[model samples]
Target: MGLLMFYEYLDKVEQLLEQKKDIELYNYLENMHAADIAEVLENLEVEDQTQVFGLLSDEKATDVLEQINSEDFSSLIKALTYEKKVTLLDLMSQDDIVDKLIELPESRQKEIIAFLDYEDAEDVKQLLVYEEDTAGGIMTTDFVSIKKDYSIYYAIETLRAIAPDAETIYYVYVTDDLDRLVGVISLRQLIISPPNRAVDTVMNENLITVNVNDDQEEVAKIVTKYGLLAVPVVDDSNVMLGIITVDDILDVIEEEATEDIFRFAGTNEDEIYENDDTLFERVRNSVTSRLPWLIITIFGGLLSATVLTSFQSTISANATLALFMPLLAGMGGNVGTQSSTITVRNIATHAIEGVGIFKTLIHEISVGIFVGIVCSLLVAVAAYFMHAEYHIAIIVGIAMWANMTTASAIGTIVPLVFKKIGVDPAVASAPFITTTIDLTGLTIYFSLATFMMANLPK
Candidate 1:
């Protein structure tokens, strides 16, 4: 639903809740999609959220359960009866069931596993063995595979029998006698092929597959690069394990992007997005994530202060030089931040690596030189007007140019260095880069002013 429509429904739901009109509320929700219902539940009070979830039929309840966020899922699960819990778990996809189970404590996860039927319980246990950010973790084991030696007609028959339980039937995998993935046959291929031909005759052997242990971000990249609806996951021996659908890749993309954004801000996502956290708890997490960076910034600021102290004589000779310090420093910091943001994004997209990193550094430095020229001219003109001294204008202008050019180099190189050291490029971050620029830019400005102090009016 559009945001306005969602709010309209929320208002109506609130009114119904206030009036204690349960039947109307149930009927109203019946028309909404599962995702929309989940959104509404997130907005409502916990008691009402549980109550509304209970109103859903078992099928709709299962669908809504899959759509709900981790925190809300936990809250609603606690309020549900054991039978209802099992019913919903059985109806949910195996991957989604594992996701919800992951949010629980080990003991709680074990308890929930025991509630599942034998096959699903085993599936959850197997999925839990893989890291949550890996291809195996997000993949569904419920995919159809046919023997390569089977006739095209037999393959079609096999697919029909398992199609109801399979997560996707857009492409059917063909396996060897040893059950190794050998080729893939699309639905279109099966439809046009001769019925008597063997599955391998028409199947495409060229395949793109990910190792079960591969990172989810890499898996997402593969899915996007190949325009695949789903990609197969394989063990080290090329044994087909499962398939990761495009929907799961979308979630991975969102999760990774959110993590990078938080890291770029020099904070942790858990600090801000912890569901159902108390205000005090949230603030504590925020402080824990943010304090180290703030401390580093404080030290960096002190270093800038030391630069000023060293240049005290120059500033005392003509107080006007001090007036342009902030402007010079601020512009350098801004340019540095822009360069760092672009570099971090390139790293995230895997667009910059090896030789590309050098190319990017050169490109950013070239950009900085041009940007510095334009900014220097504007500030130089302004400085002359403010102080009525040509030397002051030249000092600020040259400092601006030098600082910004160096800032761009620092911004580009810092993130690349972090990446080379096996750290996240985003950890190079804005505040850290900006502070570094401030220290360097101020040093350049003050030192230049000191050189030209003899030219100024005594």
Candidate 2:
């Protein structure tokens, strides 16, 4: 439905709930896709959400539950009866089931695990053993695989039997008799080729796969770089374990973006709105991430103040130099942030690759020089108009030019430095770049002013 129609439907659903029209409400909600239904639930009161969820078919309930945010899912799971919990766990994919289980306390997770079927329970247990941000954590074992010695006919029969449970059938993995992943064959190739052809005869032997221990972000990079539909996850022994599908990679991208954005803003990565954390709890999370940066910026501001104080005599004589101090510093910071954001995004997207660090820095410096000259000229004119001192205008202009060039160079370099040191570049760049610009900009402004006052025409 169009957004307006969906809104209208929500309004009607609200009215039906108000009248306790359970049967009508259930039927209406049942017709919507799980994601759409989850959206509707998100808009409803918590009590109403529980009621509406209770009315959904077991299959639909599991789907809708997975579509919602984990915090909301936690609340929904808490509201469910023990029997319903068991049913949902049984119905969910192993990867998703493990995710939900991990969200619960150990006691609760154990209880839920106890209720699962033996195979499902074992799968969830194995999945939960992987770190949350690794390939093993994100992949699902529910993919079709065939032995290299198998004939195409045997593979087709196996796929036909397991198609309902398989997460993907587009590419079937070809493993050796030892269960080592050796190759892959597309379903399209399988259908066209003769049934008697050995799996090894048709399979592409050079397969792209991720180690189970690879970081989820790295997995996302591989998927994006290779334009893969699905990538296999294998153990150290080359045993095929699971596949991370394109849809899962999309989730990883979104999650990484959200995390990077939060880190840039100096906030904790997992502060979702649906979390029932108190105001203080949220503040604590934010403060823990932000305080150290603020402390460093505080020291930086003090250093800037000291630099300005050291040039008090020059400022006292010119008086107008102080006005441009803030402007120069602010502009430098803005330019630096721009460079940092662009460079960070380029790194994330793999647009700029394998270039020498010094070369990249030099390129950014050259760009900065071009941009700085243009901006410095504009600021010089503005400074001249704002004051009568020709020397002050020249001082401000030179400071702006120098500061911007330095800022841009630092901005580009800091992220690369962080990456080289194995720190997340996005999380470390913004505060450091801004502070460096503030300190350098102020020192450049005042020192230039002192020199100009002593040498220039009066």
Candidate 3:
């Protein structure tokens, strides 16, 4: 249904609930998909959310609860009765259960663990050992695996028994007795092969797998680069632990993108807009992350001011020179930011690998020259119209070219330098680039003005 229609249905349900009409409300909620019901619940107040959830059938409630955001999920779990909480945990996928449990306080986690099935509790405990941003943490243990010695017929039979709980059956893994990853076979291959064919013989032995401790970003990169449907997660011993499916990688991509965007804007990536997060809390989170960069930029601005002070005589002699100061600095900042953003994004996506630093620098310089020439010509014409002095126009044009060239060079180099030094390029590049351009642009503008004005005709 359309979003408006869905909201309308929720309106009717809320009206029923307010009137103590439980049966009709329950029927309306029960008939909707869990995702749709979760959407409806998301729009309601917390107390009403709990009331609506309380009226859902146990199975429906569990499904809908799992679809909500982590903060919402946490709130819902808190409002649920002990019996309902246990039921919801049981119904969730192991990965989802572990994620929710990790969000709870240690005391609450212990209490919840006490009520969980022994196997489920053990699985969550094992997952808790991995850091949240690693491959192991996101993988689902519910997958079908077969012994290489098993016949295709036996593997199919095994899958039938496990299919209900397995996250995906499109691709099946084959492992040795020691649970060492050996090969992988698609369900299509299994079905097309003779029933008696050994899974080992039919399986493709060239399997691509990720180490359990590998960063989630690395895992996502591999999955995206190779177009994998699912990749196996292995321990130090190469024993398969679980598989991270394409769906999980999609979430990783979104999360990584969100983080990068926030970091680019100099904000803490974890900041969220929950009702419990007060205005001051939100401002503190944003400000603390951004303040360092602003401070750095201030220092950069001070340097630029010092440069202009040293050239005050030139500015006093030709007052028109000051008119182009902002234009030069602004253009330099833009060019630098553009180059930095492109290089950083390329590095993040692994599009260019093992390229020589000098070669990249040379290419960027060439690009800067072309861009500088075009921008210089445009600004020179504009300056001619703005200033009556031909020498002043020429000075501004030359300064624009030099400043832009310097900005582009610094932009390309700073991120590379940071990457080599094991710093996150996105977080460091912006403030550094802007600061360098401010200093360099001012220096170039004043120096060019002093030289051209001294030699050129009025």
- TM for every model, in the order presented, reads 0.94, 0.93, 0.92
Compose the digit string of candidate 3's lDDT tens values, residues 93-194: 788766766777777777767767898889778987899999999988877899999999998999889878787888899999999999999999999999
Question: In model 2, where is the ten-residue run with the lowest total lDDT?
Answer: 267-276
TM-score (C-alpha) between model 2 and the true structure: 0.93
- Cα error of candidate 1 at position 370, Å: 1.5
Best by lDDT: 1
Better of 1 and 3 by TM-score: 1
Worst 10 residues of 3 by lDDT: 351-360
Of the two candidates 1 and 2, the one with more favorable lDDT, higher being better, is: 1
lDDT of 2: 0.84
lDDT (10s digit) by residue, model 1, range 1-458? 89998998889888988898999888988888999999989998998898889889988998898898877887787788999888888888888878887877888788778878998899889999999999998998888899999998988998889888788899899889877899999999998899999998899999999999999999999999899999999999999999999999999999999888887888888686544678989889899998888888888899889988998888887798878887888889889989999999998888997899889999999999999999999999988888648888988899999999999998998988888889777865666787889988988888888877665564
Better of 2 and 3 by lDDT: 3
Q: Superposing all C-alpha atoms, what RMSD in Å does each candidate have to the true structure?
A: 2.1, 2.3, 2.5
Per-residue lDDT of model 2, residues 207-325, tens digit only: 89999999999999999989999999999999998999998899899999999898887666746544357898787777787788788778878877887788888888867777877
Per-residue lDDT, model 3, residue 287, is 81
